[model samples]
Target: MSDQIKFIVDSLNKEPFKKNYNLITFDSLGPMQLLQVLNDVLAEIDPKQDVDIREEMPEQTAKRMLNLLGILKYKPPGNATDMSTFRQGLVIGSKPVIYPVLHWLLQKSNELKKRAYLARFLIKLEVPSEFLQDETVADTNKQDISAMEEEKDQLMKRVERLKKRVETVQNHQRMLKIARQLRVEKEREEFLAQQKQEQKNQVSTESLYSGSQK
Candidate 1:
């Protein structure tokens, strides 16, 4: 079985005195916590193996390890796997600062091949507070989201304004068309009236000439 799966099973079994965990939320576990757990497990299974965590581990994985260290209220027993150590299983109950690193690590683990660490270390995953928020990262993401929303709003307003301008131009063209039609009708009527008047005047002059001749 995968070491990650094994860690999940081990973590789920930490009941009675610890918080009840339904599943291993690896994404929420920061790199440091992951490293510590792995170290503990590695020592148990392969204590003789000499692995340099910083060298062998990727940058993100190492960053996650450092981030998790910020949250440990009390260090787990120097050698954590010894059942006789008699210390509380948990090192810290809450860690809001490392939450983002945990989230990022979990989400990108597959892409980063974080599971490769499994070959070098063994771990027992732990559950901490669910609602812990990394203020720095959360704030950064919030600002990014807000900026994108504002940009979208501005683009929509520009589109609406352009639409209105197009409609206004169309209205002007329609008005010009109507005016041209009216002018053409008026000119036709005037031409017809002038022709009729000229015909009457010609008939009157011809009649007068005929009378004079008679």
Candidate 2:
């Protein structure tokens, strides 16, 4: 899965992360570096998540983070995979298993980042009457809501691109006679659907805020 590793490495080295990690290969990654990378990503995607995979991280802490990943509906690339297996590969930065997981995480990073922001927005989605009593606080919330709407527009454009790409890929795969490969494509289709739902949730949240504004 060199391609997967390349995508993760390229993404991590780019904006928001800019982690210029000198990695010749995934296998060359150490446990400390691996945990550091995981921590950085978790911070970006889910700021509310309290994860800190340190050099001497305990097993309980690692397992709890894995459970959080599970709650996020992360599926390892295998049938009925166990947490222990994921823990081992991830903790050691071993190849094959961890690469796919990391690839999936990076793929969802932008979407999750928005969701994390949406989560915070939802906390005060009602415009909280407490804040409404103060004109300054209400105005500040209005500004934040305006910024969120712009972000939602960008998210919609991205959703359009993903839909087009998925359509092209599905059409090409339909002609392929490989059942196994098609099954893999189906999983990606499901993931795209999940991302779409999250974006829809944000859109609906924005609508509620707009109505409250009026």
Q: Model 2, range 1-214, lDDT digits (tens) per residue?
A: 6677779889889988887764585457776667667767777777744455664455544554454354345666654435456566755655665567678889998776665555544423454242243344345556656777787789899999987886788555665557768888999999999999999999999999999999
lDDT of 1 by residue, 64-165 (tens): 332232222112223334312211122231233223233333334344333333322322222122211333323433454566667767989999998788
Give the candidate number with the greatest TM-score: 2
Q: List the residue pairs that clash in candidate 1.
A: 27-106, 31-64, 31-65, 32-64, 32-65
Compared to the true structure, candidate 1 yields what TM-score? 0.24
What lDDT score belongs to each candidate, Candidate 1 first? 0.43, 0.65
Model 2: ten consecutive residues of lowest lDDT: 123-132
Clashes of each: 5, 0
CA displacement after TM-score superposition, residue 183 of candidate 1 (Å): 34
* Highest lDDT scorer: 2
